[model samples]
Target chain A: MLLQFIIGLVFGLGLIVSGMSNPAKVLNFLDFAAIRSGTWDASLAFVMAGAIAVTFTGFKLVLRRPQPLFGEKFHLPTREDIDTRVIAGPAIFGIGWGLSGFCPGPAITALGFGTAAAVIFVAAMLAGMWLARFIANRPSMSGIVTPADRVGA
Target chain B: MPATSFTPVASAAGGALIGLAAVLLMALKGRIAGVSGIASRLLPPYEDREFAGRLAFVAGLVAAPGLVWLVSGRLPEQTIEAGMPVLVVGGLLVGFGSVWGNGCTSGHGVCGLSRLSVRSLVATVTFMATAALTVFIVRHWG
Candidate 1:
């Protein structure tokens, strides 16, 4: 638990230092106006790229070891099917990202930075998660549990 | 000029860095390096094993920028236009959507798509579509 909190803290702090926690920069990047004005805020892309690179290399190394740092085996996704939930979920996420300029990572990071708005965003985000659960549980929905369900809950 | 503006090289470098990080985390840690899952663990109910890896991953994220600053001479700039209310609401909606979607952009778009998961493709499409609609409604209708 401590490890997770520390990791989250570092992640959030990184967002703040990288200017990712700032919604204006994110919005400008999305709208392309910043690029037009020659004041682009491409840090989000950079941060993401850096993160991806680390993940790629890190996963390769760990996979060879036959076990994760804290687990008996590496947990990877096995399913490859697409469905309605997948389509609807991403579309909603993208729209929110484009509209608010504050995706989950930076938003939480912003919360750590003590932004009132960030706090509100996190709250709403949690609510959204619960809402998703509620909606999924509704009858006739035929909810399909993914790999995420297998993870320790 | 302020230290927050983006340069072409920095942008490209950043993207490359993220790609590299993604690959590295997978190789070294044998994990997907999804921020949502990592951040989610930070909440009250946490898992021990996931907690450590999450912290290290996040640390690397924060430290990379400082490292870049030392190598390069510039830092990215930020500007916020929408009021707090809009940002807050939008963020909340995204959180909800991510939970519903079972992943965020980094999870599905980067990792899942790379693995060619059809579910990720669907999720990515959904996220983008909803975003486009939201922007339209907020910018024009609302």
Candidate 2:
């Protein structure tokens, strides 16, 4: 638990430091109208790059080990086929991101940074989650257990 | 124009960082580093064994920014034009979407996609498309 918290703290702090908590920065990036506007901030890419670099290296190192820090073994997924769901969801997310300039990660981080607006966003996000459950329960959707259903419990 | 904005670089970096975080979490904690999973477990049914790890993950997310601030001396600024109602509504929709989709962009788009999970691919597509449609309607119609 302590380790997890520490990890989360580091993650959050990284967001803040990287300027991800600021919606304006994100908005600028999405603001296509202001082409070349100094306001456009794409710092997220760098942050992501650093993370990816580390991750690629880390995974290689860890793969040699017998097990991980907490669990019995690495739980890497082994499926690689794109489908309708993949196409649709990413498109939707991109649209939302372009429009709102706030993706889920930074939005949550924004909440901790004291953005009242973030509070509303978080609430709505939760509501959306609940709505998924309702939708999943529909007769037509019986066999489909949305990703939301598989997250925690 | 401060003559020192690294927006382009930052965006790429941020994306990579997200990817890295996912990898590390999986390697170090043997976890998927899914935000929804971590946050969801923070409250509710009370599973002690899982609680600590989830809590820690959330903590890292919240605290990473502060740590950066300590060294960089520059904090990102935020601006929201959609107002409170819209943000709330949008967020709720997204939260629901996250649940229904089984994961958010980070979880599915980055992590799941990298691992090549068919489910993740589908979920990511759904999330992206919905968000795009919503944005178009809101921007053009609303």
Candidate 3:
């Protein structure tokens, strides 16, 4: 628990330092034309590249071992198929991200900043999660990912 | 185009920190540090050995800024351009889409891609393109 807490703390601090908690910064990052026009902002490129670089190296170094250093097994994603779930979910999520300029992690971490906007966004996010759970029950698009999904999930 | 009004150094540093956190969680707990997955699993419906760690992680995430303020004497600046209605719709889309996609930037973008998962690659590319298009439409055309 302590380990996880420390990780979370570091991640949160990282968000702050990365300027991700600042929605204006994020909003500008999504503005492609502004990015091309050199007017708005485009810092997320660095963020993504840096994060991916580190994780790419770390995972390469660690995955070769029989298992994780502290745990019995590694819990990576299991599903590989690019089904409807893969396509539609992220498309919708992308639209939401563009609209609010906040994704899950930044939105959650921003709550620590005590913005009423963050508070409302978080509440609606949770509600939306619950609504997904309810929607996942229908038989047609069965096995859909949602409020209850995870693990190679 | 010359960069303006964006701090690449800060973003890279923070991204590095986030990557380190993901590595730590995976190496220590044998789990992917997907925020939505971890946060959702903390709710009542899911119960397991992982619950305590998940809760603690989320608590720490939610408190880092507060701690920074207590120590550094300043809260990080934040701005959400979207109004309440827009935020609500956006939040719902994020919640539902992320859950439906089975991961967000953290899960698929960071963790899955690190492992070189093809599904993650597809998901990431798809979302990024859609996000860019969405932003273009909303900001420019709309």
User: Which has the greatest DockQ?
Assistant: 3
Root-mean-square deviation per candidate: 5.2, 4.3, 2.8
- Looking at candidate 1 chain A, the ten consecutive residues that score lowest on lDDT are A144-153
What lDDT tens digits, residue by residue, belong to model 1 across residues B16-129?
Answer: 444454554454445664666555554544435455566555555444434445657644344445576776667666876776667886777666666656787787667755
lDDT of 1 by residue, A1-153 (tens): 344334434444445554565666555455443455666566666655555555545554556676656545666776566655566666677876877777776665454344466567777776666666666655656555433432211
Fnat score for model 3? 0.73
lDDT per residue as tens, model 2, B1-142: 1222565555555555565666667777676766755564554444346776675676666666566567676545556766766676556555655544456656776666565567876776565455545544554464
Write candidate 3's Cα lDDT for A1-153 as tens digits. 788788999989888888877777877877778846667787888888878889999887777778877789988777677787788878888888888888888989988887889989888877776666557655664654433335721
**TM, chain A, every candidate:** 0.83, 0.80, 0.87
Q: Report model 3's interface C-alpha RMSD after superposition on the true interface residues.
A: 2.6
True contacts kept of each: 0.43, 0.51, 0.73
Q: What is the TM-score of candidate 1?
A: 0.70
| Candidate topping TM-score | 3
Which residue runs of candidate 1 sit more than 4 Å off their true CA positions?
A: A33-43, A138-140, A143-153, B1-4, B7-31, B38-80, B113-118, B125-142
RMSD in angstroms, candidate 1?
A: 5.2
Model 1 clash number = 66
lDDT of all the models against the reference? 0.58, 0.59, 0.80
- TM-score of the second chain, each candidate in turn, equals 0.79, 0.84, 0.90
Candidate ranking (DockQ, best to worst): 3, 2, 1
RMSD of 2: 4.3
Candidate ordering by TM-score (highest first): 3, 2, 1
**lDDT score for residue A127 of model 2:** 59
